[model samples]
Target: MELTDNLKRVKKPDWLRVKLPTGKEYVKVRGIVSEHKLHTICESGNCPNMGECWGAGTATFMILGNICTRSCGFCAVATGKPKPADWDEPKRIAYSVKLMGVKHCVITSVDRDDLKDGGSIIWAETIKEIRAISPETKFECLIPDFAGKWENLQRIIDVKPDIVSHNIETVRRLTAQVRIQAKYDRSLEVLKRLDEADVKTKCGLMVGLGETEEEIYETINDLSNVKCDVLTIGQYLQPTPKHIPVAKFVHPDDFKKYREYALGKGFRFVESGPLVRSSYHAEKHIF
Candidate 1:
């Protein structure tokens, strides 16, 4: 069957429903984030489980800037001229984490092609600041591909985050359609670079973006070839009608099977399900 032809609306199974938002701690975290004028993927990216994640006292920091230079069809982040890097944003994030008493933190950002180093230097600084303030906290950087440059990738590796992640975003065949100027092999190389650095590497893919089952398995095999340590597979929920349309929603049971298959393929940790995101329950799964 053709990949785009896979479009078929399926019911959201029982396993997908989550508890609604309500928590005093969640409110406090939101207030802290607001006072700092910070941007988080939890809000800007329209993540499905923002309330649940914040309620648990964790948020994925969207550093560099909220605006993205690339217009990926699968994402909701605004596309425009990105603002200059905020040097103080790093220290603010460190202070916020300490205030939240978070044991671990996940930091991600939009594609900052407008910058000379693809904003890798800002990422490195942010990690350094976070480590200095909250020495006990573990940090994971979900980074851009630096437009596929080895030198740019090397810059962030120098910071030595606990986990370095670059999402393939979609299977090889659908990469051009789903992502903007992002190469499938280039992302694999990003993961490979982290693996070679002796740091834990993580990669994620969005299912139901019109990729074939064979393509998904091929993507998995490709990732395993790079020796990636962690994998996350989640359903694709179109952020808007203009964005890439969701072709199919895999059942939660199939997500389970895929998880088993990935684990059998030797990934140290695999998160697969309808609601799974790259940083979802990341702290629990990392150890």
Candidate 2:
């Protein structure tokens, strides 16, 4: 289905509207990101929270490269043969975090399937560099599954970021449809392994992807079984005509219900809403 077709059939709800990016802090963060040749999921994914996050002087940095190897139907990150990994990228991101004076930073990246370790080396180095340069700043690594390679995941666990998050993206039935190359059970295993390693583990899911309420509750139970510490639920907006169309616009009340359900299910923290993203209100998840 084309983007225009979805637009014609489904009207965006009023609650989905977001403020245009502005303010000195937003501009300064934008400039720093540009000046340092850094890429962010905020701009790459066209996140609705970009304005608010950047305005607060916090942004999630996308490392390794802007291009991805997987063509997940729900993602907006470009997919293709990615450029070679940048060995110096870790130091640069570390310096950028120090310069931004970010108290709590979020780091994520495009899938680098072409790499041997799926860019886990860069992931670990980046965290180490940031810790060395800005000892007081806490950070979270929103990582990829690395095709469920335990050794590659070990690289990240060794660095010991405050939190390690791998997004489930959608329900089990929709995993193949939304995250074309990703496996739902494998993602659960990744979170489980992180929890086993004593690293704080987190996972995110997007609603409005044709998933039923029962399926969502089942997903929460699966995550809880693995001892997932934090959870984020958000409405999915189609980025282009080529992407999957929104199945529905969930109401704010439903989001609140989900949040309460997750909290009662033993999640340490939960962020749920129409505009929520994986990294929205990310700083609070540090606990």
Error of 2 at 280 (Å): 0.7
Residue 231, model 1, lDDT: 95
lDDT of 1 by residue, 93-149 (tens): 888889889998899999988888998888888888888989999978899999877
* Model 2, TM vs. native: 0.97
Estimate the overall C-alpha local distance difference test score of candidate 2. 0.93
Tell me the whole-model lDDT of each prediction, alpha carbons only.
Answer: 0.86, 0.93
Best by lDDT: 2
| Candidate 1 RMSD to the correct structure | 2.0
Q: Tell me the alpha-carbon RMSD of every candidate.
A: 2.0, 1.8
Candidate 2: where is the Cα deviation over 4 Å? 1-8
Cα error of candidate 2 at position 11, Å: 0.4
